[model samples]
Target chain A: MSYMISKATSVNKALDEAVPLCEPVLKIREAMRYTLLSGGKRVRPMLCLAACELVGGQDSTAMPAACAVEMIHASSLIQDDLPCMDDDSFRRGKPTNHKVFGEDIAVLTADALIALAVKKLVTSTYFGVSPERVLRAVLEMAKAVGTEGLVAGQAADLAGEPMSLEEDKAGLEHLEFIHIHKTAALLEAAAVIGAIIGGGSDEEIERLRRYARCIGLVFQVVDDVLDVTKSSEELGKTAGKDLIAGKLTNPRVMGVEKRGNIFKGLIQTRWFR
Target chain B: MSYMISKATSVNKALDEAVPLCEPVLKIREAMRYTLLSGGKRVRPMLCLAACELVGGQDSTAMPAACAVEMIHASSLIQDDLPCMDDDSFRRGKPTNHKVFGEDIAVLTADALIALAVKKLVTSTYFGVSPERVLRAVLEMAKAVGTEGLVAGQAADLAGEPMSLEEDKAGLEHLEFIHIHKTAALLEAAAVIGAIIGGGSDEEIERLRRYARCIGLVFQVVDDVLDVTKSSEELGKTAGKDLIAGKLTNPRVMGVEKRGNIFKGLIQTRWFR
Candidate 1:
């Protein structure tokens, strides 16, 4: 836990410097920072660094790849928070991008951030990384966010919530699937792509992938727990909004108390062992 | 022109085949195919193929890049047809994807098509092309679609309208800029990236870039002309939607009568030269 905390703080500092450089358009960049700079666990970048080290991929290239993951992750969240989408007003314990900058600019900020990620990744002076690897990373990132990944999950989550509840497994089942694609897909990409960028061997990539899948599921499980356990002060966003909105999260479907045991059991599986 | 047509028809047919195979989800794949088969001039893909040929590239890689460009173009058109965006019911003289598939599924289709583009590009089994080159293609596509390219233009366009005619320049000044960024950026990417994949020299890539830029701009100029002078049967989609929206476009700003002279001049400068 201490190690995680220390790593996150270092990442937070890196992000502080990185986000400023992403100011392609001054107005939109301000809106991006408004939401992006808000404190969070910084899990995505941490996963990148962790995966990099696991495969012996320590270098400056890691920062660009790590930052790229964070940028993509940040962009998706901003888009998801749009009024036309989830209509979220806050996230990560602060006002969402749209809430702070209005819908037009907020959405644009998401766009800018995603572009900045690719732009930075491609242009980085990482030797022998090849335009092919960079392109693969870009494509992977796009796939992670596109229909089959995060956005698809959002669509499913939105469509499923109207019909699911305690008495029905169908809604919860859909929501769980949504969570897997939406949040977990990118998290998985963060680790696997990091491993690839860091030039990890194929076996190491797979190990990191398995490890990432475990953590991605855990992160969502934690999110589910926090949605019920955390308050507005703790979450920065509205507390219990997911529950109020009739989401089929783990806590909602499995019951808040049951969630802890399930999370623990899953992480303790043989793979993690 | 006849050669271009033959080239386009063959390219279109290949894209039509490749698109469905890449669809990760069945329904989303069908949704994507529905709009893609609807057809435009296949301008983006043609540019891609043209660049590959210009660079004297091999067939093993060029074919997939051609398909990828069309997919990106198809995805953009679907997004533009959304009720929350352009709100158009017709495209290619037929009902838009949202009208046929419904908005919920329509959004997903666009999302799926975009992802499939990445998948197809990365999954290519070609040589002399590294993963690095493929990754660069992804970044270019993302940069084209993400905030700095198309999205910013779309946002500007959305914000530009609803102002007084006096604000027309401000409103439409950005319209062309948007179309260029949103539309032409990817077209240029299609050309430039295709050359890169083909193993073209840097000089060859630059030459192709110049040619592609001219064509891309001309393509938009012709589109502006078609939206006015042509009928629904001729141009497909709504012929006068551009005029109806009071959006700044070639016919609207330059006057329908003067477009011939202006287009001629534009061609002479950007193309004929």
Candidate 2:
């Protein structure tokens, strides 16, 4: 826990410096910084750094990639909360990005952050990571953000559309597809990219990818359960709003009690074993 | 003209292959293709390929970079035409992206195209472009897309805000600032990245960068002038809409005749010489 706190602190500091309020586009930068610096658990970046260190890399080597994932995560959050998407009013206990900055600026803010993330990862060659590894990591980041990843998941979720299934079935399979692409994909990329940057063997990188995948799905399942169990204030976001919007969730599909059982079962099988 | 036609043909083919209508994200891909395939002049990609060849690199070596630039340009156009932005009803003789695929899908389409551009550039290491050059190219692309480039230009243009000027002056200087960032920056990046991929020396790359910058600004000035002079049918887009929206443009800042003179002077000094 102490290790996590220290890493989170470093990440927060790094992010703050990444985009300072400078001349000639201060508004866009402000919107970006506001969304990025808003408090979160820093889970994805921590996952990146941990994977890097577990593979014998220095913390400094993966810091940029760590920050990149966080920026991408922040970008996704802003996009998800837009009026055209989830239409959420609050996030992390504050007004959503579009609510604070107008919709146009909010959109541009998200786009800029994604570009910044790519820039940071690719330019980290100064940090002693090889260009080959940096290229691979960037490719992974792009995959996680694009059609095969978050966009597909969000689109499927919004339209409740079937994806690559033989039948247009709406079941656990569909739910898993949405969660895997939308939530787990970036987390998987985070760990995989860290391991790659650390010069881990292919086998090691694959192991970390699987580990992150399990953790990501578990995180989403728990989030779905909490949406029903917690208050809006408790969650620091609009709780039960997913249900109001008729969005699918673990609790909605299988009662909250069963979802808890599934969470524990996942831990027992994927982690303990 | 034949060289231009051949290069644009190759770019179009490469782009079609880059984003096939694959399963599990058909809708997103449709939106992306709908915007991307709509005919544009393909000027940026041509500049990229031409720069690479001039630097002694094969056209095949820079084709991916060329496609990537086009994708980035298409993404910006989609965002620019959104209702919250310019609110244009038509682009490239068809309904704008948001008009055809709803605002939500249009937004996601733009985001996906950006990601796809990065992915295409990095993964093109298979083209035998060295990792060092690819990394450099990716960094350049990011800079052109982020706050210092397209985003900054769009934000300033939308808000009519002065950028880095002493007295918030709004004239040719402000217009120049907007055009340089919004248009010239990406074109400069395209040429620079092409030169890098072609293994050009620093001097060669810098020279091409300046050359592309001049061309980009000229392109925008001519576009602004045409917006006033051409009919909607002639332009294949909404004509005279800039004046209708009271958007600041080269013709609006200086009369159309002076803008034309500037264009001729630019060609004479930058190209013909």
The candidate 2 chain B region of ten consecutive residues with least summed lDDT is B161-170
TM-score of chain B of each: 0.87, 0.93
DockQ of each: 0.42, 0.88
Give candidate 2's TM-score.
0.95
RMSD of each: 3.5, 3.1
Candidate 2 CAPRI classification by DockQ: high
Cα displacement (Å) at residue A105, model 1: 4.6
Chain B structural similarity as TM-score, candidate 2 = 0.93
* Top candidate, metric TM-score: 2
**Which consecutive 10 residues in model 1 chain A have the weakest lDDT in total?**
A160-169
Local lDDT at B218 for model 2: 87
Query: Clashes per prediction?
Result: 18, 0
For candidate 2, write residues A148-241 as lDDT tens digits.
8889889878876323223323656678888889999999999998898888989999899889988888989989898999999999999998
